[model samples]
Target: MPSRLRARDRVQGPCLGAPAYGSAVTTPRLVVEEELLRRNIDRVAVGARVAGVALRPHVKTHKCLEIARLQVAAGATGVTVATVGEAEVFVHAGFDDVLVAYPLWLDDDRATRLARLAGRARNAIGVDCTESAARARAMLPDVELMVEIDSGHHRTGCAPGDVGEVAAAGGVRGAFTFPGHSYSPDGGSGAAADEARALAEAGKALVAAGVEAPVLSGGSTPSLAHTDTGVVTELRPGVYVLGDAQQWELGSCSPDDIALTCHATVVSLAGGRVVVDAGSKVLGADRAAYSTGFGRLLDHPDARIVMLSEHHAVIEMAERPPLGTTLRLVPNHVCNAVNLADELWVGDQRWSVAARGRNG
Candidate 1:
């Protein structure tokens, strides 16, 4: 094991003091605490190692090359991305293993891009149907394909038992699924179980179809803790790297585990209400049904972000702070909030969101 990457049983140091929040700092900026960020990264990496499974963390959370490099250095097998553009960015940065986790509809341009990427790295694409699988196999034969099992997400994948034809289509390497329903208030455990069962069934179906399924992948930040590592050979969790309001509220992580925050200033004190400059444009408008509010104050946990405008957040609390007071706002969904920013601050250094806006 590397010296920098600590095991889960390792004793942690005392929590560092808060970042310097003074006149020189700017509001509506995304900031990450370096120590806490590394802590979160190592936690998952070590967890996967302890369970004897591969850790190919989804990079759609931070999208920064620096963070992805950290994961690689900490013993990650590879990195999981959402699009071909993201895969290109990481591959250019010298990441050899990349997985485009989306069931892509490969056009000519995308096929060309993926072929180029596969030439440089050991790459794979997701396929939920035989049509896409055959198209991907024909267009980019060098790239491996992973059948996407629905696994209860019901968003973009096929049913588990139906993965046989997709796997048999061509160039099938294994199977994968996303337990996204784990984001619900009490869906973590159940979703993890469903993910295990689905992946297991998919593996059996692949074998029945005469396809050898070696890589069984399934994981989400909320349900990762409850996942059956015995069934999932590879875990692809993204949000565990950056704690958000939803994770905190769902008891997935403690309040102190949060490593990222939107630094905002109290800009208003009208009618006994407090308003901050961070709003939908910065913090992102992603309030889930189970979310308590738009977001919450990291320091002032009692305060709630009741409303949000394009440029401001209306906060409700008992004691209002002074007009110039600064606060750390934990966004409801860190992934979207990060996409809205061009860069993230870690201490005084800035890291570009290199893969931002690679939506295609």
Candidate 2:
């Protein structure tokens, strides 16, 4: 069996009764448990530190400066972002080291902005093909580059054997992979192994092309526990900070570790179903092939989100808890859910989704 994250203490699950805010807070709001959030961050940070590996968490999951600051304070070397706009946000907030982990097709405006951000901090962008690599080198030579290798996700990244040419063309400082396949049911261990092998081969190819692969970056929330720290000089796992329904289903994180949840109210009980105000708009419609539902109720594991409309989520359950009941829901994918919200609530404290719509 593959190694797993350390077990966590179980809570009473998501808050069932009226939360501290009572009816003052609106329904379908994103709420986080600060203690659980810190616990999650500290656990991963300590693990990476003990293993002598650099922890550069991907900030794309949370997108809030406060949460990113927490990660940095917990000993993260830096952060990884999916877009240059996210990089711009963090770098401006004094995150000195940022990596735009996505392979960006830079136009004049994007190149100029990225170049400016690089001047303010240690920044790198991903590249897979020679054309984009050469373009990055020519357009923003001052910025560092990382060659993306297709470990298993096959979403974006060059083949392991093709890393050398791309690395050479971009003058890349290292190589990285996503291993997104780990999100599949029971795919963690295999995906982790693939990540290690792919990065290793990519590094060798880099050496063959007379390039020094100083940094080998890879990791995702699912494959993180099984990952070989020795294979990756830097680890970049995002969603770990805020456990979601997908993580819960994969057993990557326990229900007690879920820090963020959607505080939804039972709005309708008309059709012999439990319907809440949060739907695809708030929870996102990213149900994976292996996923069982649109989202999961933290307090009620047996109940599943059967249908999700724009402003309503239909919950199929044997017992309907009267209308106006407040429940905590775990979004299928926290990253997408966070992007849809303007702010996150932690008691009376509110955190702006600063990089919420920085998709560009």
Candidate 3:
């Protein structure tokens, strides 16, 4: 790399949200609305408080230390992370309580890394099967663990009724599950109900196995509003902080609730199509079967992103603008979009995506 090819050189002018700033800000930049983000955080936090449930929000959405600190200040007990690397990053940044929500099958190296991370904070990883439990124990013998149960998601977790042995094994703490199926239209309530039932069953299993399952965590933004109170002791929703197009379409969140978007430049106005520089790489190619497109054009809500390549988004807009038009596009999946960027812009300020690329 040349000396002139620095990070600063790659950046453009001032941010859009900044008052009295220039209009030539960078394209394909991850832009976060400060006020909207605060509103979103407070919404979930207040709801959890009213429901008498602990808010251990998942931090994989933003992957920014500043955002996690805000969540903690808003009354999050801890944070749920996807991998050991994320836990380490948060723990290093003064977040002592971290839970790796995904099921971990640890080897020697991974185990050692997790153990060290555990030592620096109150760490726990999710375990689905006996094999994962055994491996987790062998790797981080002193760390607490959570038994992941299949709560209608049919994901990595095991059956709630059959997790008795896994929960009773050494280093096990409680049970948790994700309401992943809630993304479907009008499926939030039912998926949340499934989460509650699964947690109850897993709790009973743990009791029968002579283990005290203290923490019962369940969450997903779509199902968060409908998640039953008593069964789940803690909620761990990630996408709520940065509302996406999917959440908007599912009636989980309104347009005003969306706080994050990709700032893109209109590079072409060919026929009825409006092409933008932001595409799958920056906005993410997460067009769910129920979703409208890759991302939603905030400037033109009705415009559909008909096509998305690595570097271009072809939006269908009847009224085409000039070549140098700027627009904000809301991602279909905010988590994936944020993970793709190195930093996020909040008005004129910038926040580093500290946990970015911690996929392992």
Candidate 4:
């Protein structure tokens, strides 16, 4: 078992000093300790640098400009975004390089926005199908494109063998894969190796067809430790900056590496269960088959969140925590949990989620 630090030591770190917690500030707010977040960012940056892979930290996890700037300052080559709105927001915030990692079918309005974004910085779009490529080309003919490969994610991207055809049809710049299957505990490293091989094969296929496959990318938090860059030039791992319950269960990060925590106030206790203010609305109801609960209580590991409604999370504790006591929780999925919050507090500093409600 990994060594666990005491709660006091964990809080005393530069991210959340003892003084920050002692302040008579409001409770029940989402907080991302600056020190811890910087530590996490530096950890991944060092790992990727040692591995000789370009670190394109995905911004979809936090969606905060301050965090994005911090990552860039810490040696990240660029930022990867999940949506056009996110790309635009980052680009407007002075991020020169952005990758829309998701396959986008551009409508007229979206096309205009994407063109504007591509004009601002070095931009790339993921293309999984010919239709998406055609739409993107019609909008921004000179835009760089990455052919998304289905390296076991089965979510998006074309098959590796079909990457050549997609690239040809899209007139893309290179090929990339998400390897999201790396999140599966039973098949994380194996999936990463397999994805690397598939990407290599895809690159060969593109080269044979007279297309220069320059950027071969594949990444996920679970696969970072086992990522093989022989065939890949860049990596896109987001949640590493805010280790969550999912990554913890996958052995991707230690508990101490988690940077973001949702502080909730205990409201009621009865029938051997204690209810907190955070629920699906706060921590998000994203319990994977391998996870223990909606979120984990940092100070009380034995406490299990039994149920989560829209606004209440019923935590079963051996000893009831006093009502009005503040409890810090590490959410199961940091990305979704961040999407639920309007803003995030980073130590004494705070930043609003200027792009929060943008589903587009």
Model 2, residue 236: C-alpha shift (Å): 0.7
State the lDDT of candidate 4 residue by residue for 116-231, as single tens digits. Answer: 77767999988888778876787788878888888887888888888767676655767888888887775679878977997898888788767864678888888888888787
Q: Which stretches of candidate 2 lie over 4 Å from their true place?
A: 1-23
**Model 4 weakest 10-residue run by lDDT:** 11-20
- Over 4 Å off, model 4: 1-20
Clashing pairs in 1: none
Model 1 scores a C-alpha lDDT of: 0.88
What does the lDDT read for residue 298 in candidate 1? 88
**lDDT tens digits by residue: candidate 1, 186-209:** 889999999999999988988888
Which regions of candidate 1 fall more than 4 Å away from where they truly are?
A: 1-18
lDDT of each: 0.88, 0.88, 0.86, 0.81
Give the TM-score comparing model 3 with the true structure, all chains together.
0.93
Tens-digit lDDT string for candidate 2 (324-354): 7778889999999999999999766999999
Mark the regions of model 3 whose C-alpha exceeds 4 Å error after superposition.
1-21
Q: Tell me how far the alpha carbon of residue 52 in candidate 1 is from the true structure, in angstroms, after superposition.
A: 0.5
- Residue 257 CA error for candidate 1 (Å)? 0.7
Model 4: how large is the Cα RMSD against the reference? 6.6
Instruction: TM-score winner between 2 and 4, please give it.
Output: 2
